[model samples]
Target: MDLNIFREYDIRGRVGPQLNEATVATISRALGTFFAANGAKRIAVGYDARESSPIFAEIMHRELNASGCDVVSIGMVPTPVLYHTVYTADVDGGVMITGSHNPADHNGFKICLGKGTLFGEQIREIRDIALAAEFAQGSGTIEHRNVLNAYCLDVVSNVKMGERKLKVVVDAGNGMGGVTAVPVYQVLGVDLIELFTKPDSTFPNHHPDPTVEENLEHLIQAVTEFEADLGIAFDGDGDRIGVVDEKGRIIWGDELMVLFARAVLRERPGATIIGEVKCSQRLYDDIEKHGGRKIMWKAGHSLIKAKMKETEAALAGEMSGHIFFADRYFGFDDATYAGARVLEILSKSSEPFSSLLADLPETHSTPELRVDCPDETKFKVVERVSDAFARTHEVITIDGARIVFEHGWGLVRASNTQPMLVLRFEADTADHLDEIRDEVEAKVAALIAATAA
Candidate 1:
């Protein structure tokens, strides 16, 4: 097994080369051995609609069983459904076979151990055990259960959308979102417009990643044509949500948190909210203004979830569309649950969805920018850039380096999932945004050159 696939957040890689059935089977055995040693006797396993997911699941089932753990197979569902099963079934561990926003040819696993996500060094340990051919001897049972109905019912039961129903659009992008979202939204009594809701691993209409504006074009258009109140799109596994207002304007993840924060603070004053460093500073300020405590942490859903657990934050989100609400539900990032909460907020208000945030301080911000730097050198480049900036500017190094300027801020962070660096900038004005971005870009380029030299 290639240890590189054992990322900071989850295990993922290109399907043919690194994530083939045999490779996943070995990794599954490793996970099983680790789980059995940790006293996990019962485990829940699920897979996405990706073509490779089922094959991965079968192998995982046999391996986990071989390692002395019962496998609860919740087959062919969204990633969150797998998470739901783990909690509902009271399992000691869970693994969801999903590639998330990556293209169809790439796939991986999101794992949970004892009600919390398994990540970081924990994932690396599995890789080490896999390479060493570690094994535990026993034959455990396997059971199949369909938890989709229960999961959907649970979401509707928990979320109070109020008496007023919303007219909404849901674009699953031909991914697994439709498998669960369709049922949940239908029961919510919303005037729903379903687009590309079919489960097609090819992602025929658009990519499943909602963070990429291009994937949301069809969603935006659907919102306008349907004249719906708003629209929501989900990633491949349905954990990240992308929203668009009635006016066809994209409501980013951080902005969505701000909206959720306002409502949460009104209900529970002094609530703690967590946002990633990549989020606009405005989000933190808005939380403070609303009598809420704000914390900016590293990017990545697992990292944010861990921080939320430590901080007791009611709400937490990343710029990439992973939103977690611990106040009324489990702490994992579940876009399906978030969509209902969003509609609930809109239902209780008379104003347009866009108007809720009209009072926010406006600023020019750039979407996340990706720069291709090999995985081995990405962190080094960030370190050099951080050192140079720290000498003359205030830099936040929680994840990578975020240079704080009087007019705005610029962030350069290593992408946990890919061989690249993620860059983002925001400022009080367009010119200032450009200035800071250029400064950071030039410094990054110089460091990359120096590293090569």
Candidate 2:
């Protein structure tokens, strides 16, 4: 087992050296042992459209069964669907095998224990069990089941939509979202246009990540050509979502949260909503202005979900497009479900798609910026830079360090998934945004240099 594959959020790595049948099976057995020790009798397993995902899912089922846990297979589905199973199904835990917007040659497993995902130290401990080949001994059982129809119906049934007949385009990026999204949206009374509905492991059109502007370019073009009300896109596993307005403006996650909060607050007044450190300050400000409480927590969906439970928040969102709604539906991040919610909001309002966000205070913010720093050195570099900034600025060290300036805020944190440092800046103006970004980037460069020396 390669220790590096055990990330802070989910286990992910290139398929070549680190991930193979033996390693996957070993890790699965470790998970089974972990679950069995935790009093979990049955677990569910699902996979994405990635070429290796189904194979890995089968291996996990075998290993978990060997460890005495009855495994229910959901076949190929979205990551959120797997998460949905944890709540709707009778299983005690769940796992989803997906690359999650990574390159085609990469894949990994998102494991859950008792309806909650394991992260940080919990993920690292899996390596210890797998390396020692320590697994529980018992004969288990495996069975295949389909939860796609039930998932779609549950989402569609919960969300309330109007008869505005929303004309929208959905770009699945050739991922697994279309499997469930098509049925859910079809029943939602909308003139929905679907793109890349087929689940293709090769991703012949473009990568599945909707966060990248390049990936949303096609969605943008199609929305304009079709004169659609708006456009929505989903990542590989269909958990994260990205949006394009009627004018083809890329509506990021933070901005999307602004709309979601408004709708949620209207019904449940003064409800609490959570946004990560990298989210725009405008989001917090607007949420408060709307008589809703706002909490800024760490990134990562697992961390955000845990915080939601702690704060009893109605909603939570990350800058990278992970949007969680505990308002009308489940607390987990589901892009397809969120997309349907978006349409429901638009169907009620007569305002243009761009106008849905006109009430929020304006601020210029850069998309999350990532700098390549080795995993071993990334956190150290962030620490050095964070300490340097703390000496002068009012820095928030929730996850890494976020420097709060008079005009803006800058964040530099080590990415839990990759070998890099993630940065984001938001300011009152373009020049101020540039200034904040440069100041923090210079410190990052200096820290990297000091590490080399």
Q: What TM-scores do the predictions have?
A: 0.97, 0.98
Residue 305 local lDDT, model 2: 94
Clash number for each model: 0, 0
How well does model 1 score by local distance difference test?
0.90
Sliding window of 10 residues with minimal summed lDDT for model 2: 125-134
* Error in Å for residue 180 of model 2: 1.1
lDDT of 2 at 357: 89
Query: What are the root-mean-square deviations of the candidates from the true structure over C-alphas?
Result: 1.3, 1.2
Please, what is the whole-model Cα lDDT of each candidate in the order they appear?
Answer: 0.90, 0.90
lDDT by residue (tens digit), candidate 1, 1-453: 677889887899999888888898898999999998899989999888888888999999999999999999988988888888877776898999999889889899988888789878898888788888968879999999878889888888888876777899999998888887888888888998899999898988889999999999998998899889999999999999999999999999889999999999998999999999999999999999999999989887878888998989999998888989887888888999999899889999888899998999999999989998988799999999999999999999998999999899999998887889999999999999999999999999899888878
User: Per-residue lDDT of 1-453 in model 2, one digit per residue for the tens?
Assistant: 678888888888889698988888888999888888889989999999888888898899888889999999999899999999998899999988999899899999898998798898888787777788878988788889988889988999889997688888999999987888888988998888989979999999999999899999999999999999999999998999999999999998899999999999999999999999988998999899999999989999999999998889999998889999999888999999999999999999888899988777778888888899987798899888878988888989898899999999999999887788999999999999989889889989889888867
